[model samples]
Target: MWISRLSRFLDSVKQTLFILGTGLVIFLALRNSIVWHMQEFWGASGDFWQRRWEELYLLFNQDDFLLSVFGTYIFTTAVFWLCNLFFILLDLTGKPEFLLKYKIQADKNTPLRPADFMKAAKVALYNQTVVGLPMSVMIFCVMKWRGCSCSPADMPTFPWSVVEVTIFTLVEEIGFYYTHRMFHHPRIYRFIHKKHHEWTAPIGLVAIYAHPVEHALSNLLPVALGPILLGSHLATAWMFWALALFSTTVAHCGYHLPLLPSPEAHDYHHLKFNQNFGVLGVLDRLHGTDAQFRASLAYQRHFLLMSSMPVTQQVPEPPKKKSVSE
Candidate 1:
């Protein structure tokens, strides 16, 4: 049994490695050209916008306090709303036929009521302003004490920025995996983590609809620890935070659009509650928490969708086992 599990685990790791390699290749090939074009565009921008941009950048760098208090709040709020509103609209529209094909939990997630949206929005708002703002201040203090650089001149180059974010992702995966699994302990689940699991078929807005303690430990700390440990540039830290928020929202979006990361694994986590407790699948595989997921029909359906065609839940049959003689 252990041997079979190890084989499956190895196959998943190979797939993850292949995806990582392909992403790095593409990022390396395009980043220089992209940066060059961006610089050219900035250079060509008229004096009016250029001055405004400079002023904004200066203001952002003027003090870590302002950035921590206002910048984090504003940036996270904007990204959260932008990402979730799009999906909220889709859900409000009964998930039009065009998108219905990709809805992972279509059967389970019936149309949400107005009150449901209100409850989610209200809790999300409280978390963002009431809970998040103070936490941001604390994180800023920690980062500053740890000697993280906020200087624009000291910002990492694009490749190094990528490297930093990658490390941040790995750190977050480890932190989140263990903290999340711990939350599932019966002694603690109801008091803290249960609120997050309220949306069994999660929507985008519900991504951060967690208990404040759970939000702080599982959602915020994991993402922040990497930059703090590395003493990364403030800019790099913010970039990673944005990506983390967006990706977490996408993971809970319930729709598996083509060209995006598959939501199947997380959607399954929401459904079953006991499997897939990590941001990335790395820790889950090592801990064997994903055993049931790997054996389930959803595992067969878990795929990188490349076509606009509608997806179905049809699980293909396993191949016949060969006899020793054959």
Candidate 2:
């Protein structure tokens, strides 16, 4: 018991470090570029700088923020959206029957009908383009104002760049866990988070299928938090967004692929409704929510058995044969 508790504690600590590390990388990356401009225009040192505030306000107003917001969000979202859509289609097509083993809720997944797939795809994509896009724009605006770069030159190259992206990803996941939990509040869930839940058996693109407010707050905000806090490079932030989007997409893909974060965790969240709220399940475990979630899963198994729904239950192994001598 103590060993398990310690493991969870370490995971939380590692995640905290990732957040701080990401912020540090951003601050360092932006210091010469964005921050330098900030200091120069605002005056590095001045009388409690009330004038600097006025100057900064004018700079904010004059800069082409709308272009920055829309352009960055659209481009980054498109790149990963395509990547996600590709994998989703791959899973649906299942060129090799062996790949089916990766499916999570295997029995519950109805035979893929062209009409049904299209309908689900349509709704998911619609939500992303409409609701998700605006949220991304807003999040980009916040990160830009706070000092994250929009210039490619600002990004550190190659292996080193991975560090920045890696840390920010961890930070984003942690931020998402808490923000998502709040979205499930009784008052908020029906009005906002419920839209995403409409598809109990979610598809890849459902990652972004959500109410506008929920997308902005629960989805984009957590993602945006890392770059804003870190003051990350444009490329670093871009890569982070790409990876985070892919992760969410796969988590909704309804697959239980080995050596990958499968859909099981979030699938349970969607189906069961009240448990497994965290992206990585670290926060859920630390908070003891995972125990409740596991219990619910057990209940589901029991219910399926009691209802004699063999089709929905996993196939049991055949009884062992005994030797005649025994």
Candidate 3:
């Protein structure tokens, strides 16, 4: 029995890894292809930045800009990973039973209609375009105001220090954590966040997908907060933006593999509507919100099993549709 169970566990691991690896490859291919075309189009522009190996090395040697960029990268990535780590642990180990209990039912009989897919796509595009462009511009303006040079060659020179990055990381974390939770509050959620929740089981495309107001509020806070609190340079800010987008996409992809947390961690919250609230950790544990989440999962599994029984034992279907003329 133990051997059989071990074999099943290994098979599950393999399947999960396969899904995650494929998703990542697809994401990278799409992202890089778009980035390449964008570069080709804008490369000649004086304001556009081209990422090249030589230039990257040169930029690193420039103490001030390099220090700032590296600091921001470490800070943001650390906070993002740490938060995901905490939640994954909670979901996977702290409550392994939660996984089996709260499995989301795939409504096979009522497959996701075309309309649902379109709505999700539309919301995703609208949210990204409306919020991303304006926020990018605002961040650019702020960087200019702060006298931070954007050009790779013109970057400032400063000593590399862990202390600086640590401080910046804390500021960004606090800003993101509070802003994220605030949007989920009932009052704000109705107006700003409800649209994103339309896809309870998100599939990566809907990662940044949100209502315009919510999108603006969510994206702008980190951009604005970094400059005001940490006085980060433009390069650092841009890196932060890229990392944030990548991480958000991963969180919504609904697959887990080595080196990353499971989408189950975040997807479960959306499925049940209340729990795992923190972007950086399991805040639900401290606040007792996870209780309902546990119960909801159990409720979902019971219904799912009942719904999956043979058609003979299932409820009768509605009468067949009559002809339009009839």
Q: Please tell me which predicted candidate would have the highest lDDT against the true structure.
A: 1
lDDT of 1 at 245: 85
TM-score of 3: 0.52
Ranked by TM-score, the better of candidates 2 and 3 is 2
Candidate 3: give the clashing pairs: 64-156, 64-157, 64-158, 83-280
- Residue 107 CA displacement from its true place in model 2, Å: 2.3
Report the backbone clash tally of model 2.
3
For candidate 1, the per-residue lDDT at 224 reads 92
Q: Model 1's lDDT to the true fold?
A: 0.82
Across 117-144, the per-residue lDDT of candidate 3 in tens digits comes to 5665576556545555555556555665
Q: Report the C-alpha lDDT of model 1 over 127-199, residue by residue, as the tens digit.
A: 8888898899999899989988665556566567778888898889889999999999999999999999999
> Which digits, one per residue and each the tens of the lDDT, describe model 2 over residues 1-326?
98888887787677566644766678788777966675565453432343443443354463435435654556666865685765556556764665565555666443455665676667656666787666666676677678766543343544455666666666766788787888888987898888889878777767877777776777777777777787876555666778787788877877655455546668888888878888766677676566666665432432212222241245443468999998
The TM-score between candidate 1 and the true structure equals 0.85
Q: After superposition, how far is residue 109 of candidate 3 from its true place, in Å?
A: 12
lDDT ranking from best candidate downward: 1, 2, 3
Candidate 3 all-Cα RMSD = 15.9
Which is the leading candidate under TM-score? 1
Whose TM-score is higher: candidate 1's or candidate 3's? Answer: 1
